[model samples]
Target: MVFSKQVESPITTEFFIDEPTRAKIEYQNGKALMARGPQALHEHVVFHMEKALGRALPQMEVRFKDVSISADITVKDEMNLML
Candidate 1:
């Protein structure tokens, strides 16, 4: 969840995520504010990589049977975010 008081009333936004979400939230002088959702950042990274490479990159996923697990693992070569 995120909160902002830049308006007359406080604004709240909620998100459901499967991965650890990255956020940039700032409050200036306890009034003005700024924030970005993790989804937005993910799209930005995907867009830039696609544009720079001139092609869409392949994506992968894996699953396990009879067991449940949650972990931060590396998918691609991006060291910034681990799945």
Candidate 2:
């Protein structure tokens, strides 16, 4: 199993801005956690999940790892209601 790594040293917003990474970085409660790139298995799972969700809930939109801020997956209605 894989888990996100917590940054050891305290970091400022400036440091986070200076650092560049393709992986996602999440900051919360004075701590920073970096997410690893999705593995092949993980991608496969997410793809299938999205497909199934799209079929089952045709009226809703399904997104995976596309939110600008902090969301692994999001399913929202046409009116953009967060569920």
Candidate 3:
């Protein structure tokens, strides 16, 4: 996936999905976050993680707040919250 940011402002973040299992986050701080080859559950929890932070991050820099998981996608991935 590709990401670009503008040269101004309070900071806007956008996410994209490709290959179904890969996720990307583009932040206004000239940062691009990518998490590739995640299981279905990893995708779900990461979505929620972004949401949870979005709600409380009016004054924080979200680029540093981004989180990611491992590339391994096994049953253990689900057991570890990839589900």
All-Cα superposition RMSD per candidate: 18.3, 20.2, 16.5
Candidate 3 TM-score versus the reference? 0.22
lDDT of 3 by residue, 1-83 (tens): 54322222366544434334444444444223333333544544555565677642233454645677669654555557843
Q: What does candidate 2 score in Cα RMSD to the true structure?
A: 20.2
Output the better candidate (1/2) by lDDT.
1
Q: How good is model 1 by TM-score?
A: 0.39
Model 2 steric clash total: 0
- lDDT rank, highest first? 1, 3, 2
Ranking by TM-score: 1, 3, 2
Which residue pairs come into collision in candidate 1? Answer: none
| TM-score to native of every candidate shown | 0.39, 0.21, 0.22
Consecutive 10-residue window with the lowest summed lDDT within model 1:
3-12
Candidate 1 local lDDT, 1-83, one digit each (tens) = 33311212123332323223434334463232323655555544655575699765565456578997799985756676667
Evaluate residue 20 in candidate 1 and report its C-alpha lDDT on the 0 to 100 scale: 33
Global CA lDDT computed for model 2: 0.39
lDDT of 2 by residue, 14-36 (tens): 11111223344454632333243
- Cα lDDT of candidate 3 equals 0.44
lDDT of 2 at 13: 17
